[model samples]
Target: MKTVILIGAQGHMGQAAMTGLKKHNVITASRSGTGCDHTVDITSKASIKALFEKVGPFDAVVNTVGYCEYANFSEMTDEQWDTTIQSKMVGQINLVNVGLNYINNGGSFTLISGILNVKPIPMAIADATTSGAIDTFVQCVAHELPRQIRINVVNPTVLEEAWDVYGEMMPGFQPVPGALVGKAFERSVDGFITGKVIFVDA
Candidate 1:
C-alpha cells in the first residue's frame, strides 16, 4: 500500500481522512502529538526534515491544519495577521517546499481550504486570502514539480455540524457532512488529477 501522512491528525478532518485513507500506509502527525504516530511542527524546517527522515519515504502528504484570524482588515491586529501568515500560508507552503525531497516519485500532496476562498464574508479576509494562496501554490507547483508528483486542494462549504458555531456568518450556504469532506481528501490523495481545487459543496 502507498504511504501517506495526515498532518493535524487529531482534528475532525484528519480523523475522517484516517478512516477514508485506511487502505494506504497512513502516518499521522500533530503539533501537539495527539492521535498521531509523529509530532510535526510544520513552521520549522528542521522539524519537517526530521519527520521525513524518520518515516523514510511516503507516497503522499495530506495537510489538514492551519487556521486564520477573523477581523476587519483595519481592525486586524499585527499578531492576527502574522499568525495567519505563519500558520496558514507560510507553514503549508514550507511543507510543500521541504516535503519535495521525502515523498516518492509520482506521489501526491493534498491540502484543505474552505468555501471562504470563493465566497466572501466580512472579517474573513485572512482566511480567504490564505485559502486562495494555497490554491495558487498548488497550481503553480503542479507544473513545476519533478517526478510526476501531484498537488491539489479541497475547498469545502460550511460543514453541517459546524453550523452551530458559524451559521450566522455564512448565511444561505448548504452545509455538508464531515464524511463527504473526508472523501474529497481521499480523492485528492489517490486520484490522478493535479493542480485542481476539488469543491465539496453542499
Candidate 2:
C-alpha cells in the first residue's frame, strides 16, 4: 500500500482528502493533532523532522495548511501579513525541505495554493502574492528534486462551505465544493504531471 503524509489533516480540505484516498495509509499532522496520526508544526523544521521519523517513508506528501489576510491593503496590519506569509509560504517551503527526504524516490508532492494568485481579489494582496510565490517555487524546485519526484500545486477557488460565512460579502462569487478540491489533490498524487499548477473553479 502507498503511504501518504498529510499536513493539516484536521482542516476541511484535509479531511476530505482523507476520505477520498482511503486506499492509502495516511499520516496526518496538525496543530490540534486530533484525528491525525501524528502532530507537527509546519513552521518548524525540527517538528517536521520529528514527524518524518515517526511516519518512516511515504509515497507522497500533501500540504493543506495556510492562512491569508482579507482586508484593504491600507487596513492590513503587519501582524496579519506575517501570519499569512509564515503559515502559507514559509510553511510549505519548510515542509518540502524537511519532509522531502522522507518520500520514496519517484514520489509526488502536492501543495495547496489558492485562486487569488490569478484572480487578484480586492483586499487580498498577501494571499495573491503568496500563492504566486508558491507556484513559482514549485516550478523552480521541480527541476531539482531527485529520482523523478514530481511537484505540483492545487489552486482552488472559494469553497462551497465558505459561502455560508462570506456568502453575503461575495455576491457573485461561486464557491466550489470541498470534495471537488479534494479531487484535485487526488489527481495530483495519482497522475504523472509535474511542475503544474492545477486550477479548479468549476
Best by lDDT: 1
CA lDDT of each prediction against the hidden true structure: 0.86, 0.84
The count of backbone overlaps in candidate 2 is: 0
Candidate 1 overall lDDT versus native: 0.86
Q: At residue 92, give the lDDT of candidate 1.
A: 88
Superposed on all Cα atoms, model 1 deviates from the true structure by an RMSD in Å of 1.4
> Where is model 2 poorest over a 10-residue stretch in terms of lDDT?
163-172
Top TM-score model: 1
lDDT value, residue 64 of candidate 1: 87
Q: What are the models' TM-scores?
A: 0.94, 0.93
Which residue runs of candidate 2 sit more than 4 Å off their true CA positions? none
Q: What is the C-alpha lDDT profile of model 1 across 1-202, one tens digit per residue?
A: 8899889888766876676687888888989887689999887889988898988989999998887899999999999988887878888888889999888999998988778979898999999998989888888888988899999988888777577888899878898887888888889887899999988886
Residue-level lDDT tens digits of model 2 in 1-202 = 6798988898876866666567788778887788778888887788889988998879999888887778889999999899889978998988888767778988888998888778776778998889999999998998888888999998988778667775665566778888888888888888899999988886
